[model samples]
Target: MAESTPGFELPLLLFAGFRSIVDQLHAELARQGHPDVRPAHGFAMQAIGRDGATASELGRRLGVSKQAAGKTADRLAALGYAVRVDDPADARRKVIRLTPHGYDVLARSAAVFEELRTAWAERLGEERLRQLEADLRTMAPPSGFRLDVAGWFGA
Candidate 1:
């Protein structure tokens, strides 16, 4: 990634592994009847906390433009997972909140994550898995990294 030799390295390998894990997790969730939600969608969901968040706020949190965040909000609304309502405090502003179904998706995804972790441990030794997790946490976490359900399923 730096000005160096053009070959495989730790960063690339880590990215590939991250992508693989996310892809597999999505596939497993699909098998268990979760909707066609991608990791990026989880970002919007997370930004829009239970108290709700404006599209501007989501854009700030996601490091994207307001329009981009609005687009994501539009997609969530179209998917019946989110709704944009006028802020009670400020009638001119809009905030996004998850639908009951969206909450269900989050809950189900959490369960599937546990299931996947269990399966991985069963296949590749629980102690090794634990060490791997711990080692990752040991590495300096990048900016905006939160150890939450949605953080595990990152954008």
Candidate 2:
């Protein structure tokens, strides 16, 4: 066989690239004054955006247990990024919603992600990055197929 790329295998390269992206994401969050934010919370953050939902609902959406989602919500509450309030239609149940701070963080993080994507576009031409993104989406492994905590987070 002719020589292949003299570097890591494809799967290993993909994994390393993903890890690097997540690392950059966390660094951006911290640099934006969200030191308490974490990769784990990224799931909770998306799940609890805008109108928000019950902890149970969040758990279901994230494919995590209700207890795990509750704990994450608790952490967000403690950080002043989220608040648990009585559900309007059902006082017995609580809903987690993003605080003003949380909304700001969300907006800022979106900009950070754009910056990261732009950097990638610079490395590989914008058109190439667009094709790569489409290819990744088309070839992405099934969500249920993931076995790591990172699986809880979305693309």
Candidate 3:
């Protein structure tokens, strides 16, 4: 008889898989000339979006404190990944937006993610990979996409 897997092993294995993918992605990103990008920055950039967002807005979207969001913005600016410009609608506010370099990183990240998925499919067999993804979708909540994962993890 086959032994049952422990419940604790499930989350651990899932996280390990995620960590492996993220680690590989970052390594590739560094090789592609974005050595300074961090996992948090991806969430931040998604929150910033194409239109941009004020610190408070970004903080809300990221589920972090305004101060935390401001710090992130500062770091992104220092890395030339983002910029803060005066808000046209609200003269009193500054909106954070991704720089061209930042957009390039996002685009490159997308391409790398596709490559990683293709690699996984090749290794696991396309059918098995598809089944795995289907199983995940069935198990996971239907929350669409969440940008607050960084804050949730931090909390």
Point to the candidate with the largest TM-score.
3
Backbone clash pairs for candidate 2 read none
Which candidate order results from sorting by lDDT in descending order?
A: 3, 2, 1
1-155 per-residue lDDT for model 1 (tens digits): 66875567877988887777778778876777765788887767877878878988887777777887899899999988799999999999998999997887778777877887888899889999999888887895655365243334345
TM-score of each: 0.82, 0.84, 0.96
**Residues forming the 10-long window of minimal summed lDDT in candidate 2:** 145-154
Model 3 residue 70 lDDT?
Answer: 97
The lDDT of model 1 is 0.79
lDDT (Cα, 0-100) at 1 in candidate 2: 100
Of the candidates numbered 2 and 3, which has the greater lDDT value? Answer: 3
At residue 95, give the lDDT of candidate 2.
97
- Score candidate 2 by TM-score against the native: 0.84
Ranking by TM-score: 3, 2, 1
Best by lDDT: 3
